[model samples]
Target: MNIRPIEINDYSRWFDLWQAYLAFYTVELSDEVTQKVWERLMNEDDKDLYGLVCEDEDHVIGFTHYFFHGTTWFDSSYCYLEDLFVEQSVRARGAGRALINGVKEQAQTHGAAKLYWHTDKQNETAQGLYNKVADLTDFIRYDIALKP
Candidate 1:
């Protein structure tokens, strides 16, 4: 599988897959929100926000979106694997693995101290794959959206 940065040309089908991804997470975001995410993915000033696409011939089987986050915990930086998905029909076919390995390779090349991300508690299929590659962090995550 070949993995590379996502391009604007990938928008249409990629957005469809992203919508499916949100549905899987039970997120009720609108298409406008997704469009903004696509913009962020392509933001020229933020080159560190990146995505890896797994494809063969003409088919895009999977994608992984990630970003580099500066952290006080590390002298270097960390790669946050924010979203990763393999099409339902292509699950377990190494698509996810290829994307993950690509991100790891990028982090290593950038001298990142680590790569990490969270998964939903009920995502056993992803956990099975993650178990082979990463250790879960002991910390819990919380967020508060800012509103006026």
Candidate 2:
């Protein structure tokens, strides 16, 4: 019911939610890889990444990981919301909204001009919620993963 910035001590709970988020995306990254990502998120030098947790009685039910993106047109940097998820059983209860709005507040704190994120093309539920909070950008995200 409460949303707060993610602390180092909250990793175990955050990990559970993280795994669920990946599963939702049909990803199967190794735990070791995920741990490295956790380290990056907590690094003091990295102000670009901000993580938040949604909790109830010391249990983490959701998370939001956001950061800044360089943009030429705005006075403030663009806020890129990287990840957001709430446990399935708890959907429609506002945890996702809490995490997103918390990201919005953090973006404002960091002097960001706008906040943005991408959902899978088929993710109808999330799109519905997102349209209510922010406008949909016309851009489509494309990725080209590096090959070793």
Candidate 3:
């Protein structure tokens, strides 16, 4: 598997993996939102948002989207691995690990103070991978959805 920064030409395959990712979470996002995300990932001037894709045999099989942000507790920025997905057929072949290592390389390159991500509580399969790659924090996440 080859991991590299995402290119504009990788959109179609990336979208397929993106949709599968959402499906895995049983979530749906608007097309406009998706378009905006793509735009941000592709924007060279946008230093915060970024994306990477993993390919096998010249076919994109997985993708990850991440971003860097300032935090009150840290001087340097933190990298958040926002989204990650691999095609169902290619799940356990180290593609996911390769994608994450790609992001870790980027975060280190950017001098990020920390790298973190979240997964649903019941996602044991993903947790298995996360446990291998990162420390499990005891902190709980809370969210408030604001009305648009």
Q: What is the lDDT of residue 55 in candidate 2?
A: 89
Report clash pairs, candidate 2. none
- Cα error, residue 108 of model 3, in Å, equals 0.4
lDDT of each: 0.85, 0.88, 0.92
Q: How well is each residue in 1-148 modelled by candidate 1, as lDDT tens digits?
A: 7888788888877877887888899888867877777888899896757887888666787788888888999799988899998888878988888899999998898889999999999999999999998887789989999974
lDDT of 3: 0.92
Candidate 3 runs further than 4 Å off: none
True-structure RMSD, every candidate: 1.6, 1.4, 1.0
Off by over 4 Å in 1: none
True lDDT of residue 24, candidate 3: 91
TM-score, per-candidate, Cα-based: 0.91, 0.92, 0.96
User: Pairing residues by index, what is the TM-score of model 3?
Assistant: 0.96
Span of ten consecutive residues with least summed lDDT in model 3 = 40-49
| Top of the candidates by lDDT | 3
- Compute the lDDT of residue 3 as modeled in candidate 1: 85
Given candidate 1, what's the lDDT at residue 123? 98
